[model samples]
Every structure is written in C-alpha cells, then in structure tokens.
Target chain A: MSITISNISKSYKNVKALQDISFEVKENELFGLIGPDGAGKTTLFRILTTLLIANEGTATVAGFDVISDYKMIRNSVGYMPGKFSLYQDLTVEENLNFFATIFGTTIEENYDLIKDIYVQIEPFKDRRAGKLSGGMKQKLALCCALIHKPKVLFLDEPTTGVDPVSRKEFWDMLKRLQQKGITILVSTPYMDEAALCDRIALIQAGKILEIDTPKAIVKHYSKPIYNVRANNMYQLINSLNDYEYNHSVYPFGEFVHYTDKRADFNQKELKMYLETKNLTDIEIEKTIATIEDTFMELAK
Target chain B: MKIILYIIQKEFKQIFRNKGMLPIIFVLPLLQLVILSNAATFEVKNIKFGYIDNDHTSTSRTLVEKFNASTYFDVLTDFPSEGLASSSMLNGEVDVVLEIPQYFERDLQKEKYNSLGITINAIDGAAAGVENVYVTQIVQNFNQNLKVDLLQVSDKQIQPITIETIPLFWYNETLNYKTFMVPGILVLLVTMITLFLSGMNIVREKEIGTLEQINVTPIKKSQFIIGKLFPFWVIGIGLLTIGLIIAKLIFDVPMVGSLVLMYFYTSIYILVILGIGLFISNFTDTQQQAMFIAWFFTVIFILMSGLFTPIESMPEWAQILTEFNPIKYFVEVMRMVMLKGSSFIDVLPQIIKTFLFAFIMNGLAVWSYKKTT
Candidate 1:
C-alpha cells in the first residue's frame, strides 16, 4: 500500500472534521475522495501530508509513519492545497525553480516528469503567477508540485475553479503521472470526476458513506432509478416527493431522478400522480445508476 | 546550505518585485531622517515677551532692551499696567511676562539690592524652565554692567570679586540639536523598518496560504527562518548606511568613531529586531495583526528608547524597564559611537546585552514557530 490510514480522527474546537476515517491507496493507484464542501476531505489531506496531527489513530504515507517518520514522509510527497498557494510575485518559471530547489532537485533532473504539464504553460513562463488566467495558474501549480518528482501526489480540489477543458486536461495528465508509478490521492467536490479514479471513497459530514470502485459502487445501489421530466421542474419534483411510494427525489441536470420505496414500484402511478398535479408533458423512463446516485443513496 | 540559499534568493526576488514597498523601504526612511532630524528639536526659541514698566526709569528700559536684543525672546509687547500684561499672557500672546517694581532705580542705588517680578507661562513645563533660564541670564548680565557703572560713580578704588563658572560642552560644542538627534532618529528608522518588514513578511505568506504549502516541504525550520530574515537584515544595514551618509553630508553630524564599529554593532542589533519580528509573525495569522502588534511594540520601543527623553530622569521603575529595551541600547551606542567617539570596550556592555537579546529572542521565535500543527 502506498498510503494507509487507520481510524484517523481530527476535530477543530467543537466541530469534528474527521472520525475513524480509515482507508488505503495501493501503489501506482489513482484514488479519489468524492464529497461536497465541508466534508473533511481537506482535513484528511492535511493529516496525511503531515501538515496537521490527527486527534486520534495513525496513518502512514510512502511507507513512513505519519507521526514517527514525518520527516521522511515530507521528503516523499507532493501536496497541492485546495487554495492557490504559490508565490504570486514570482514568475511561473521562478516559482517552479524555487520548489525544485527546495526539494533538493533541479528542473532538468525531473524534466521528463513534468514536461507534459509544463509545456502547456511554457509560453507564459515569464508572466507572474498572479497575472495568469485560472487555467494557467492551475497548470503551473501542478508543474511546481511535480517538479520534485515525489513518490505520491496529494491534490485537494485541483479542478474546483478550473474550466471544463482544463479540468479534462488535468485529469489526463494525472493518468499519465500514474502510469509513471506515482501513487495519487486526490479530492474533488464534482462527482463526475470520480469515474476517472481507480477507486473512490464517498464521504459526507466527516463520515465515509461508501468506498469501492466507481462502477461497483454505482452497481451496488441495486435500485431501479426512473428519469422523470415535466413542463415544470419545480412542480414535477414537488409532485414526485408527495407520491406515497417515493423513496428519493433528486434533480439531476434536466431530469428528476426518482426511486420508489416498494421493491415492485409502479412507474404509471408516479406519472399519474404528477399528471393530476398541474405538470404537463410528463415523461418517465428507467435510467442507469451513476456514482452520484450511489452517493445520494448511501448518504440518505 | 543550498536550500537556504535558494530560499534567500526567492525572498530577495519577491521583496524587490514589490513596486509599492520598494520606496517605503529605501526612500521613506531617508526622507524621515532629514525631516524628523531637523523638525524634532529641544531648543526652545522665539518666545513672546511682554512686560510692565512700573519703575518708569532708564534702568528698566535698558532691561527691556536687553531682552529685545536677545534672539531667544521676541520682546513683542510693552504693557502700561500689570493687569494688561496678565491678560496678554492669558490670551496666549506672550510666554514670558516681566514686571518691574515701582522703584525707579533709586532703590537699587540706595539699598544696593533689588528684585524684579518675572512671570512665565508654565503650560509646557520644560519650555517654561528653559525660558526662565534665558530671562535670568539677561537680567544677571544687566546687573553686572550696572555694578560697574555704579562703582565708578561711588567708589572707583575698590574692585569686587565674583565667582564665574564657564561650561565647556565637550562632544557637541555648539549644542546643535540636529547633531544630537540625527543618530537617534536613524536608530528609529532602522528599528522600525526592519521590525515591521520582517514581522509582516512571514505572516504575508500565511495569509496567502503559501505557508501551508511550505510547511509540507522537507525544508528545515532554521533554513526557512534564516533565509526569510536575511534579506531584511541586509535592508536594515542598507538603511543605516544611507542614514549615515545623510548624517555626514547633509546634517554634518560627525562620525567621530570608527565606521567599522558602528557597522558591527548595527549588524548584531538587527538580529535582535529580526528575531522580534519573527516572533511576532509566529504568533499572528494575518498581516494586519502582525502589523498592529509590530506597531504597538515599535511605539513603545521608540518612546522608551531614550531617543527623545533622557532615561536617567525617568522614574526608577521606568528606568529599570528601559534596561530591557533593545532600542535604548542602540540609541546609546549610536550616540556614543557617532558623537563621543567611543571605542569597542566602551560599548562592550551594550554589545553583550544585544548579543544575548538576539540569542534569546531568536531562540524563542524559532522554538515557537511550528511547521506542523
């Protein structure tokens, strides 16, 4: 295992950030922690990176104990915090060089590791980090984190504020880095990104709801979800929620995903109930379950 | 070693890249040195003078004329009655009021002794005291001349002997306020700028979230701290150099001692300031908090530094408090070295104390500074 966390718990004052959070990431694996905001993803990242001490339990990264061998762990991991943390005054090239030097390595020594990402923002090498667009800054931050070529990389919400195209490119680069034998533990609030990981842990309110491969997690939901749409999304949702057999009702993009309480659920009954209410053009069809559906089911 | 150098290089790059802060670091202190040294003075001048001549004699007119001739007094008004003079004083038109008694010079010749009534505005006690000394000197000079004129008329054969004490101001012969103040103000500029800059630098990293990123790196604490502080140390010395040049060329403040000794002392003195700055940064989470705390201590340090007031005259307890003040020692050392030409051994005790301060403050700062929490 490249990372091992056992019963790690952390609290800030009265709020529990993490409780009995135990998990593992195999070597060369790209693991994702998928959750919404304030879900203890950052706290877990900080603890594993040795920037914070857990209130209980223990963890290790890159085969070194987080507490007893924190120094060794620090030397072996690359952490990109959720916030943009590079020096804004320094040029992109300077920021990259600075991180490389502090890690006891040089850019030329690890050019092969960061070439794909660095080349994307190489034209803006002279521009200060503060002046770059959001996408470029994210790329530069990734380049800086990878310049030292550590054994594991921890990215906290790297795609939170990025555009769609850059977010896709960022994940593709992560795939390439994983092929180079680097273990990666990343967190994101966007559930769609979970499918790109080898495995994911679904978390909410400091508790892990489920952990498994994204496909397996979604398959384990074992409920037939129906996509229901009408002229009025609000009225459709309200009518479905008022149905007697309704188990769950969530708006997913253009359609309302609904699950029934009974094992032998009747779709005609739900459609008839929405028709009586004032909603028009109602359509109901069985839809495949997704990671988001599984997360919603487990969280509920 | 290499990592520390890289960190230092990065720090210098960031410091120089800040366009708004460059002038604050370099130009403002020199400007303050020139403006404050010339403006902040102790010698009180241009005191408004008003008097009532109840004596109505040539002797009283001569006394008033003496005050008019002196540069220290403006001799603004001549009141007909004591009440008018009192009202003028009340209205703040005059600072010193002299009332000659109704004796017309006859009492002086007959009794061989007389006293004049001198009223001074004591609102500013120190300035009032200086004004009083000036008034007495003029009156005493007039008395000396009067004795000569009277003795010639009455008895020319006998000569009276009087005791005289002539004070020779040793280091500052002319008592130029600028010469005395330039070094102290230079100390203030150096201490204030270095303390504020060093204190806010680390907290700026914290505010921007870069500190969290750096904390995860394998960089040692000493390497990070020394690298962060080294640039400000150089800037502090750079300020002292600029201030000294200004002191030499503009103010003509003498550099009586060796320049090497001043630099050596300042080099060590800056360490104490940087340590204090780092300590402040260690405790604060924001630049604003660090700045407020730095300003708080800088004000206290500047006031108690004996820069403006003499520490010897403070209450015993306050005097003891100043013993712990680092600026007090810097002020004393700068004044002693620049004005009095004091040698190394003369400032050895200060050197020892400052060295200890640097050690303790930096130790506490580094110890309190945590990379992991």
Candidate 2:
C-alpha cells in the first residue's frame, strides 16, 4: 500500500469532521475519494499529506508515518490545495521558477515532468497568474505541484469548479503521472469520476460507508432497480412514491430511479397504478445500477 | 540557507512588482517626513489673550502692555466683567483669560501675596501645558521688574543668595522644533513601513491562498520567515537614508553623528519591528485583522516613544512601559546620534537594548510560526 490510513478521526469544537476513517491506496493507483462537500474528503487528504494531525489514529504515506515522518512525507508528496494557491502577483514562469527553487530544484532539473503542461502555458508565461483563465490556472497549479517530482500526489477536489473539458484533460494528466509509478489520492464530488478510479471510497458526514471498485460498488446493490419516465417527471415521482410496494424513489435525470419492496414485483401493476393517478405517458423498465444509485443507497 | 535566499529573491520581486506597494514604501514615508515634521511641535505661539481689568489702574494696563509686547500673546480684547471675559473664552475667542481683582494693585503693594486669576483652555492637554508654562514665565518677569524697580537705588541683582543660572540648551541652542522632530519622525516612518509591510505581506499570502501552498512544501519555518523579512529590511534601511537626505537638503537638519553607526543601529532596530510584524502575521488569519492589530500596537508605541512628547515628562509607570517599546529606543538613538553628534559609544547602550529586543522578538516569531496546525 502506498497510502495507509487506520482509524483516523478529527473534530472541531462541537463538529466531528472525520471519524475512525480507514482506507488504503495501492502504488501507482488512481484512488478517488468520492463524496459531496463537507464529507471529510479534504480533511482526510490534509491528514495524509501531513499538513494536519489526526486526533485518534495513525496514517502513513509512501511508507512513512504522517506525524512522525512528516518531513520525509512533505519532501516526497505534492499537494494541490482545494483553492487555487499559486502566487497571483507572480507571472506564470516566475511562479514556476519560485516553487522549483524553494524546493531545492530548478526548472531544468524537472523539465521532463512539467514539459507538456508548461508548453501549453508557455505562450502566456509573461502574464500574471491572477489574469489567467480558469482552465489555464488549473493547468499551471498542476504543473507547479508536479515540478517537484514527488512520490505521491494528494489533490483535494482538483476537478471541482472546473469546466467539463478541462476536468477531463486534468484527469488525463493524472493518468499519465500514474503511468510513471506515482500513487494518486484524489477527491471529487462528481459521481461520474468514481468510475474512473481503480478503487473508490464512498463517504458522507465523516464516515466511509463503503470502499470498493466502482463496478463492485454498483454490483452490491441488493434490490432490483428501475428507470421510469413520464410526460411530467415531477408528478411521476409523487405518483410512484404513493404506491404501497415502493421501497425507494428518487429522480435520476429523465428517469426516476426506483426499487420495490415486493417479493414478486410486477411492472404492469406499477404502470397501472401510475396510470390511475393520471401520470400519463408513464414508462417503467428495469435498468442496471449506477454509482449514483449505489451512493444514494449507501448514504440512506 | 540556499532555500532562504530563494525566498528572499522571490519576496523582493513581488514587492517591486506590486504597483500599490512601491509608492507607499518609497514616496509616502518621504512625504510624511517633509510635511508631518512641520505639523508636530511643542512650542506654543500666538496665544489668543483676553483679560478683565477690574482695576483700571496703571498696574493692570502695564501688565496688559507687557503681554501685548510679547509675541506669544495676541491680546485680543479687554473685558469689563468676569462674565464677559468667561463668555469670550466660551465662544473660543481666546485660549487664556487673565482677571485682575478689584484691589487696584493695593493687595500686591500691601501684602505682597496677591494672586492673579489665570484661566486656560485645557483641551489638547500638551498644548495647554506649554501655554501655562509661558504664562507663568511672563508673570515671573513682571515680578522681577517690580523687584528691579525697588532695587534701582541699591543694585540690579535681587541678591538673597545669588546663584545665577545660565540656561543653555545643548545640541539644540535655539530649540528648533524641527531639529528634534525630524529624527523622531524618521523613526516612525521606518517602523510604520517595516511593520505594516511585513505584517500585510505575509497576511496577503494567507488571504490569496498561497500560504497553504508554501506550508505544504518542505521549506523550513525559519527559512520562510527570514526570506519574508529580507526585502522589508532593505526597504527600512532605504527609507532611513531617504529621510536623512531630505532632512539635510530641505530642513538642513544637522547630521553630526556618523551615518555608518546610525545605519548599523537602525539595521538591528528594523529586525525587531519586522519580527513583531511577522509574529502578528503568523497568528492572524486575515490581512485586515493583521493591519488592525499592527495599527493598534504601532499607535501605542508611537505615543509612548516620546515622538511628540518627552519620555521623562510622562508618569513613572508610562516611562517604564516605554522601556519595553522598541520604537522608544530607536527614536532616542536617532535623536542622540543625529543632533548631538553622538559617537558610537554614546549609542552603545541603545544598540545593545535593541539587539536584545530583536533577538527576543525574532525568536518568538520563529517559534510561533508553524507549518502544521
């Protein structure tokens, strides 16, 4: 394991941020910490990166204990905070040179690692970092984080507040870095990103509900699920929810993801029931489980 | 050590590139040194004088003439009654009220213990104090003239035990206010620039989210702080040089002391101020908070540093408080060295105190700063 977290907990005054959270990420694996905001994703990343200490338990990154060997861990890990943290006043090139120099390295020393990203931003090297567009800023932050050539990378909500194309391109960079044998511990709120991770830890309210591959997580759904669409999605949900055998119901895009409590559920009966309620053009069919469905199920 | 040098280089680059900081660091201090020195003074001039002559004798008129003859009092009006005199004072027509009693100079000639009723506006307490002293000196001169009139047939000297006092003010023969104030204001400008810049610069990084980026790196805490202070230290020295040149060129302030020794003392003093600033930056979460706290302490230090008033004149407790103030020591050193042509030995004690102050302050700063929470 490249990252080992065993029973780590943290709290602020009256609110518990993380509680007994345990997980591991393998070497060269793209491990995604999937959660909504305030689910302790950033907190766990902070503890593992040795920027914070856990109150209860121990964590090790790159075979070094987080608290005891924090210096070594800090030397080896590259952390991009949730916020865009490069010096806004410094130009793109100056910002890069400053970080590299402070880390006891030079741009020429780590030219191979940042070449691709730097080239894209090289045209605007003279421009201040604050004036860069969002996509450009994201790329620059990544380049600076990678310039140190760290053994492990901890990215907190790297893709949050990012455009779709840029998000995809950023993950692609992470994939390339992973190919170079660097362990990646990344957190994101988007459920779709879960499918891209080698293994995922589903988190909520400071607890890890489940830890498994995305396919396995979705496969763990015990009940047969359904996707139903109608002329009006709003009334369709209220009408289906009024059914006596309905176990759970929630809207997922154009379809209402649903399950039944009945031992022998009948789609024809559910359709007839919706028709009686005047949910016309109602369509109901069995569908495979998605990560969102699994997340909502476990979160319940 | 190499890492610290890099941090310093980066800090200098940022300070120069910041258009807002450049004028404030360079122009503002010099402007204040030139202009503010004129505004700050203790010499009371042009007092608005109103008096009630209840005794319309030669004694009261002669006394009024004495005041009018002196340039300090303007002698705005003569009132017929106490009510009118006090009313003019209430209307802000005058700062001082002199009321002669109805004795027609009989009390002084017979009893030789008559008291004049002198009322002064006490607002801006320091100005009021100086005004009171000037009025007392004028009254003493009047009494001396009376004595001299009596002794004309005998001798000019009022000889009980004649110990003639030859009052001479050294280093400031004329007691020019600017000669004293320019050196003190220079200290304030240097303290203001270094303290505010170091405090705000680090706190700005915190505000911009860059501090967290620096914190997560392998940089040592001391290295980061030393790097941050290096540029402002140079700026402080540069400010001192500019202020000194302005003082010499415009105000013709005497620089009898060695410039090299002054720079050496100021270099250490700037460290103390910057250390305090960085310590404040380390604990505060926002630049606004740091600015407020820095402002609070700087105001207190300036007030207690005897920048506008004498430290010896303050209460004993307040004087003790000034001992802990680094600005106090720097202000004293600047005045002592600049005006008195004080040699290195003259300022050695202040230099040692400032060095200890720098050591303690920077030690606290480095100890309080942490990379981890």
Candidate 3:
C-alpha cells in the first residue's frame, strides 16, 4: 500500500472530526476521500501528510510512519492545499523555481514533468501570481506542487472554486501525474468528480460511509429505485409518499427518484395511488442508482 | 539551506513585483527620513517678541536696541502698555515680552538695583528654557556694561562664572537628526513590511484552498516553513539596502560601522520578523485578521522601541519591558553601527540577543503551523 490509515480518529474541542477512520491507497493509485463540507476529509489528508498527528491510530505513507518518519514523508510528497497556497507576490516562474529549489531540484531537472502544463501559461511567467486569472492560478499552483517531483500527491479539494473548464483541466492533469507512477490522494465535495477516481471513500460527518470503486459501489445499491414523473410533480410526490407501499421518496432533478417498500410492487399501483389523489399524467419507471443515490441511501 | 535560499529568492520577487506596496515599502521611509530629519532639529531660531517700555529712559531704550540687534529675537511690536503686551503673550502672537518698569535707569544709578519683567510662553518647555537662558545672559551683559561705565577705575574687578557642556556626541558628531532617524525609521519599515507580508501570505493560501494541496504533498513542515520565510527575508534585506543608499545620498547619513556587521545583524533581524509574521499567520485564518494583528504588534514595537523617545528617559518598568522588544535591539544595533562607527565587538550583545529572538520566534512559528486535521 502506498498509504495506510488505521483507526484514525480526531476531535476539535466538542466536535468529532474523524472517528475510527481507516483506509489504504495502493501504489500509483488515484484514491479519493469523497464527502460534503466538514466530513473530516481534510483531517484525514492532514494526518497522512504528517501535518497533523492523528489523535488515535497510525498512518503511514510510502512505508514510513507519519509520526516518526514525518520528515522523510514530507520530502516525498507534493501537497496542493485546499486553498491557493502559492506566494501571490511572486511571478509564475519565480514561484515554480522556488518550490523546485526547496526540493533540492531545479526546473531544468524536472522540466519534462511540468513542461506540458507550465508551457500553457509560460507567456505570463513574469506576471505576478496575484494578477493571474483563476484558471491560470490553478494551473500555476499545480505546476509548483509537481515541480518537486514528489512521489505522493495529496490535493484537498483542488477544484472547489474553479470554473467548469478549469476543473476538468485540473483533473486531467492529475490523471497525467498519476500516470507518472505517483500515488495520488485527492479529496473533493463534488460528487461528480468522485466518479473520476479509481476508488472512492464516501464520507459524511467525519465517518466513512463506504469505500469501493465507483461502479462497484453503485452496483451494490440494493434499493428498488424508480424515476417518477407526473403533470403535477409535487402532488405526485406527496401522493407517492402517502401511498401505503412507499419506502423512500425524494426529488432528484426534474423527476423524483424513489424506491418502494414492497419489492414486487408495480408502477400501476403507484399510478393508481397518484390518480386517487387527483394527480394526472403520471409516469414511473425503474432507474439505475448513481453515486449520489448511493450516498443518499447510506446517509439515510 | 537550499530551500531557504529558494524562499528568499521568491520573497524578493514578490516584494519587488508588488506595485502598490513597492513605493510604500521602499520610497516612503526614505522620504520621511529626508523631510522629518530636516524638521526635527532642537536648535531654536526665529523667536518673535514684543516689549512694553514704561521707563522711556536711555538704558531701557538701549536694552530694547540690544534685543533687536540680536538675531534670535525678531522685535515685532513696541507696546505702550503692559496690558497690551500681556494680552499678546496670552494670544501666542509673541513668544516673549519684555516689560520695563518706571524709572529703571534712575533706580540703577542711585540704588544699583532694578527689575525687568519677562513674560514667556511656556508650552514647549525645552524651547522656553533655552530662550530664558539667552535673556538672562543678555541682561547680565547689560549690567556689566553699566558697571564698566559707572566705575571707570582700571582696578575694578567682577566675579565670573561659566558652565560649559563639552558634548562628545559619539556615533554622529554633528548630531544630524537624520543620522539618528533614518536607521530608526528603516527598522520600522522593515519590521512592518515583512511582518505583514509573511502573516498575510499563509492566510491567503488558507483562504484560497492551496494550503491543502501542499499539505497532502509529502513536503515536510520545516521545508514548507523555510520555503515560505526565505522569500520574505530577502525582500526585507533588499528594502534595507535601498533605504541605506537613500539615507547616504539624500541625507548624508554616515555608515560608520562595518557593512558586513550591519548585514549580519540585519539577516538575523529579518528572520525574527519573518518568524513573528509566520507565527501570526498560522493563528489567523484571514488576511484581514493577520494584517490587523501584525499592525497592532508593530505599532506597539515602534512606539515603545524608543525610536522617537529616549529609552533611558522612560519609566524603569517601561524600559525593562523594552528589553523584550526585538525591534529595540535591531534599531539599537543599526544606529550603533551606522552613526557611532561601532565595530562588531561593540554590537555583539545586541546581535546575540537578536539571534536568540530569531531562533525562539521562528521555532514557535514552525511549531504552531500545523495541518488542521
């Protein structure tokens, strides 16, 4: 395993940020800690990176214990903090050179690794980091983190504030970095980004809900899901929940994806129930569960 | 060490690239050194005076002429009444008013006794004291003249007393206030700029979510800190060099001490400031908060550092409190080196104190910077 975390628990004053959290990322794998805000994603990342000591449990990155071998661990990892952490006053080229130098390396030595991304905005190398557009800054920060040629890259919500196109571009860059045989641990609140990961840990409220491949996790969802639509969608939802056969009913997009308590119940019964409530033009069909659906089910 | 140099290079780039703060950090200190140094002299000149001569006698007239003849006092008005002269003094229109009493010459001739009323505005006590001394000296000279004229015997003798202060002002012989003020103000500028920049740099990263990216990386805390502080240190030194050059050319402030010694002390001083800034940055989550806290401490340091006031004159407890202030030592060392031509041996104590402070503060800063898991 490239990374190992066992029974890692942490608390902040009165709030429990993580509880008995354990996970592992294999070498060169793109692992993700998926959760909403305040789900202890950041806490776990900090511990693995040796920035924070776990309250209870042990975590090791690349065969070195986070506590005892922190210096060695730090030397090998590339961390892009959740925030834009580069010096804003320094120009793009200067920031990159600084990070490279800190790692006891030079831009020319690692130019092949970052040249692809760095070249895109190389024209503005002299421009102050603070003045760059949001997308450009994101690319520059990534370049700086990668310039050190770290073995393990830990990115905490690298796409939180970026535009859609830039977000896509950033993820693509991460994939290329992963291709270089670097262990990648990335966390994000965006569920859509979760599917891009090779394996994901669904976390909520500082607890790991589940950990599995995206397809496998969705495949394991056991509920009889249905996407229900009707002319009066609101009334149809109320009528469906009020129905005696209802298990769970929640709005998902333009239609409501629901499940029934009776596994063998058909759509005719649901339609009859909706019609009895004076709801018309109702349509109901079975649908495949998504990661969000799995998350909602697990959260419940 | 390599990481530290990288950080230093980055810091220099940032300081120079920042258009808004470049002028403030570099130019403003030099401008103040020039303007305020000229304005801050203790030598008094151009005193305005008014007089009420009730005696209307030759001796009183002659004394009035003597006052006019001296360049120190510009005799603006000759009032007929004491009421008018006193009102002018109360209104601050005149700094000093000489009131001559009735039959001043006759009394001097018969009884060898006379009195003169001298009213002075005493708001600025130091200047007022000096003016009083000058007035007393002139009166004594006038009395001697009277004695000389009345008792023409060559054998006549008079007692004389003189007080002299052989002021051996070490460091700055001429006592140019700029020589003192430039180095002191430079300390403030360096401290303020570095503290604010370093304090704000980390917080800004935290706000923008990039700190997390670095955190996940295998980079060590020491590496990160060295990377961050190195740049700010370079910028601080660069600003000091510019300030020194300006002080030399525009103000003619002497660089009496060894340049190498100055650089050595300044390097340690920058570390102390950068450490303080990083420590503050680690605690604050926002740039605004970091800036406010940095500004607060800097204001206190500059005010209590004895840049504008004598540390010796402050109450004993206040003077004791200043011992803990790092800026005080930096300012002291800079002035000692620049003005007094002090060698490294003379400034060894301050240098050692700064080195210890830099170590403690930087250690605390790195200790405090943790990944908030």
Candidate 4:
C-alpha cells in the first residue's frame, strides 16, 4: 500500500474535523476523497502529510508511519495545499528552484518528471508568482510540488478555483504523473472529477460514507434514477418533492435527478403527477446513476 | 549549509524586490540618525532673565550686570518691584527672577552677609535645574569679585586661602550632546529595523500560507530558522555600517575604538535581536500582530535604553529592569568603544551577556518552532 489510514480522528476544540476516517491507497493508484466544503478532506491530507497529528489512530505514507517516521514521509511525499502556497514575491523560476534546492535536489535532476508541466509556464519564468493568473498559479504550484519527483502526491482541492479548461488540463497532467508510478491522493468538491480517480471515498461531515471504485460506488446506490426536465426547473423539483412516492429530489444542471421510494417506480405516473401541478414541457427518462447521484444519496 | 544559503538568497531577493520596503530598511534609519542626533539635545539655552534692584547701589547693579553678561540667560526685563517680577514670571516672560534686597551693599559692608531672593520657573524640571545652575554660577562670580574688592580696601596684607578646582571632561570634552547621542541613536536604528523586519518576516509567510508548504518539507528546524534570520542579521549589520558612516560624517561623532571591534560586537548583537524577532514571529500569526508586539517591545526598550535618560537617574527597580534590556547593553557598548576608546577586555562583560542572550533567545525560538502541530 502506498498509504494506509486506520481509525484516524482529529478535533479542534468542540468541533470534530475528522472522525474514525480509515482508508488506503495502493501503489500507483489515483485515489480521491470526494466531499463538499468542510468535509474533513483537508484534515485528512494534513494528517497524512504530517503537517498535523491525528488525535487518535495511525496513518502511514509510503510505508512510513506518519508519527514515528514523519521524517521519511516528508522526504518521500509532495503536497500542494488548497491555498496557493508559493513565494509570491519570487519569480516562477525562482520558486521552482527554491523548492527543488531545499529538497536536496535540482530542477535538472528531475527535469524529465516536471518537463511537461514546466514547459507550459516557461514563458513566464521571470514573472513573479503573485502576478500570475489563477490557472497559471495552480500550474506553478503543482510544478513546485512535483519538482522533487516523490513517491506520493497529496493535492488538496487543486482545482477548486481554476477555470474549467485549465482544470481539465491539470487532470490530464495528473494522469500522466500517475503513469510515472506516483500514487496520488487528491480531494475535490466536484463530483464529476471523482470518476477520474481509480477509487474514491465519499466523505461528509468528517465521516467516510463509502469507499469503492467510481463504477462500483454508483452501483451501490441500488435505486433507479430518472432525469426529469421541464420548462420550469423550480416547479418540476417542487412537484417531484411533493409526490408521495418520491425518495429524493435534487436539482442537477437543467434537470431534477429523482429517486422513487418504490422498487418498481413508474415513469409515466411521475410525468402525469407533474402535469397535474401545471408544470408543462415535462420530459422524464430513465438514466444511469452517476457518481454525483451516488454521492448525494450517500450524503443524504 | 547549502540549504541555508539558498534560503538566504531567496530572502535577499524578496527584500530587494519590495519597492515599499527598501527605503524603510535603508533610507529611514539614516535619516533618523541625522535628524535625531541634531534635534535631541541635553544642553539648555536661551533662558529669559529678569531682576528687581531694590537697592539702587552699584553692588546690586553690578550683580544684575553679571547675569546680563552670561550667554545662557537672555536678560529680558528689569522689574521695578517683587510684584512686577512675580507677574512677569506668571506671564511666561521670564524663567528666572533675582531680587537684590534693600541695603544690599550696606549690609554686605557692615555685616559681610546678605541674602538675595531668586525665583525660577520649575516647569520642565530638567531645563529649570540647568537654569538654576547657571544663575548660581553668575551670582557666585559676583560675590567673589566683591570679596576681593572689600579685602583690598579693608586689609592689604591678609590674603584668604581659596581652593580652585579645574574639572577636565575627558573623551567628550566640550560636553557635546550630539556626540553623546549619535552612537546611542544608531543603536536604536539598528535594533528597531532588525527587530521589526525579522519579526514580520516569518509571520508574513504564515499569513500567506507558505509556512504550511514549508512545514511539510524535510528541511530541519535549525536550517530553516538560521536561513530565515541570516538575511535580517545582514541587514542589521548593514544598517550599523550606514549609521556609523552617518555618525562620523554628519554628526562628527568620534570613532575612537577599532572599527573591527565595532563590527565584531554588532555582528553578535544583531543575533540577539534576530533571535527575539524570530521568537516573536513564532508566536504571532499576522504581520500586523507581529508588528504591534515588536513595536511594544521597541518602545519599552528604547525608553529604558538610557539613550535619552541616564540609567543612574532611573529608580532602583526600573534600573534593575534595564539590566535585562538588550538595547541597554548595546548603547553602553557603543558609547564605551566609540567615545571611551575601550578595548576588547573593557567590553568583554557586555560581549558575554549579549552572547548568552543570543543563545537563550534563539534556543527558545527554535524549541517553540514546530514543524507539526
């Protein structure tokens, strides 16, 4: 295993940030911690990177105990926090060179590892990190984190504020990094990004609700879902919630993803009920459960 | 060692690149050195003088003429009565009032003793005290001359024995306040700049979240701290050099001690300040908080540093408190070496104390700094 966490719990004052969170990521696997804001994803990452100590339980990164062998873990792992944590006053090249030098290596030593990402921002090598755009800043942060070419990478919501196009490009970079045999433990609030991981843990309020392959996790939903659209998205959601047989109703991008309480739910019945409520242009069709539907169901 | 060097290089880069900070580090302190040494003075002058001649005799007129001849007193007005003198003092027209009593010359001739009434405004006690000294010296000179004149008329052969003491002021012979103050103010500039800058440096990283990134690295605590503080240490020395140059060129303050010794002492002294700064940065989270705390300590240290006030005049308890003040030792060392031409052995006690302070403060700073919490 590249990482192992068992019964890890942490609390700050009265609020418990993480509670009995336990999971593992195999070597070369791309693992994701899927949750909303304040879902203990950052707390978990801090614990694994040895930036914070868990109040209870134990975690090991790269076969080194996070507490006893923290030095080894620090030496072998790379971390990019959610916040942009580079020297803003330093130029892009300086920031990269600094991180590399402090890690007892040089950019030339691992040029092959970061060459693909570095080339993108090479034009702005002399520009200070603070002057870079949002996407460019994230790219530089990722490059700094990967300069050491470590065995594991901990990226905490690296795409939270990035544009969609740059976000896709960032994910592509991560895919290539994984191909180079680096185990990645990433967290994201975006559920669509969760499917790109080899395995994911659906987390909410400091607790892990489910952990499995994205395909398997969605299969675990065990309920039929319908993509129901109408002229009025608000009334369609309201009508679905008002129906007695409706198990759940959520607005998911131009449609209401709904589940019926009964195992044998009738689509025509749901449409007839919506029409009665004066909700026109109602279109209901059976759709496969996505990772988002699974997460929402598990979160509920 | 190489890591520390790299961190130092980065720090220098950031410091030079900051447009708003370069003047603060270099220009402001030098300006303060020039302005403060010239402005903060101890010698009081331009005392307004007034007198009432109750006896219209030559003796009283001669006494009044003595005060008029002195450079310190302005001799502004001659009041006709004690009431007028009191009113003039109350109106803030005069600082000193001398009332020669009635029959002043007759009493001195018949009884050989007479008292004169002298009043002084006591607001700004230090200046008033200086004014009183000037007044007494002038009156005593007049009395001495009167005694000589009377002795020659009364008995020519009898000569009274008198003791005269000629005091020589060493090092600062002219009692130049600027010469005394220049080196002390230089200490303030060096201490304040290094403390404020180093205090805010690490906390800035914390505020910007780079501290968390660095914490996850494998860098040792000692290496990071040494690297972080070394740049400010250099700035402190650089400031001392610039301040010394200003002290020599602008103020004409003496540098009697070896230049090498001053640099050697300042190099260690800056470590003590940098250590305190690092300790403060370890506890604070924001640059503003660090600056506030740094400013608080700086104000206290500057006042208690004996730069403006003599340490001997401070209360016993406050004097004891100043022993722990690092600026006190620095001010003392600067004056001793720069003015007194003291040797290494002369300043060894201060060197030992400052080195111990550096060791303890840096130790506490390193111990409190945690890579994980």
Best by TM-score: 1
By lDDT, the best candidate is 1
Provide C-alpha RMSD values for all models, in order: 1.8, 2.9, 4.5, 2.7
Candidate 2 local lDDT, B260-331, one digit each (tens)? 999999999999999999889988989899999999999999999988878999999999999999999999
Candidate 3 residue lDDT tens string, B67-119: 88888889999998988888888888999999999999898888878899998
Which runs of model 4 end up more than 4 angstroms from their true locations? A228-245, A262-285, B50-62, B78-93, B99-114, B148-152, B155-161, B371-373
Predicted candidate 4 versus true structure: per-residue lDDT over B100-156, tens digit per residue: 889999999998799998899998899988988888898888888998877755475
Model 3 iRMSD vs. native:
3.5
Residues B152-189, model 1: lDDT tens digits: 54476576678999999999999999999999999999
- Give the fraction of reference interface contacts each candidate recovers: 0.91, 0.83, 0.67, 0.85
Distance (Å) between predicted and true CA of B329, model 1? 1.0
Q: Estimate each model's TM-score.
A: 0.97, 0.92, 0.82, 0.93
- lDDT string for model 3 (A1-300, tens) is 999889999998999999999888999999988888988988888888877777899989889999998878877887777767777777788878767776678899989899889999899998988899989988888888788788888888989999999999888988998898998999998888999999999999989999999999999899879999888877877877787777788898889988888868888877787878887778889899988888888988
Tens-place lDDT per residue, model 2, A174-268, is 88888888899899999998899999999999999999999999999989999999998888888877888888899998899999998799999
Give each prediction's DockQ, rounded to 2 decimals: 0.82, 0.74, 0.41, 0.75
Off by over 4 Å in 1: B81-84, B110-113, B151-160, B371-373
Q: Model 1, DockQ value?
A: 0.82
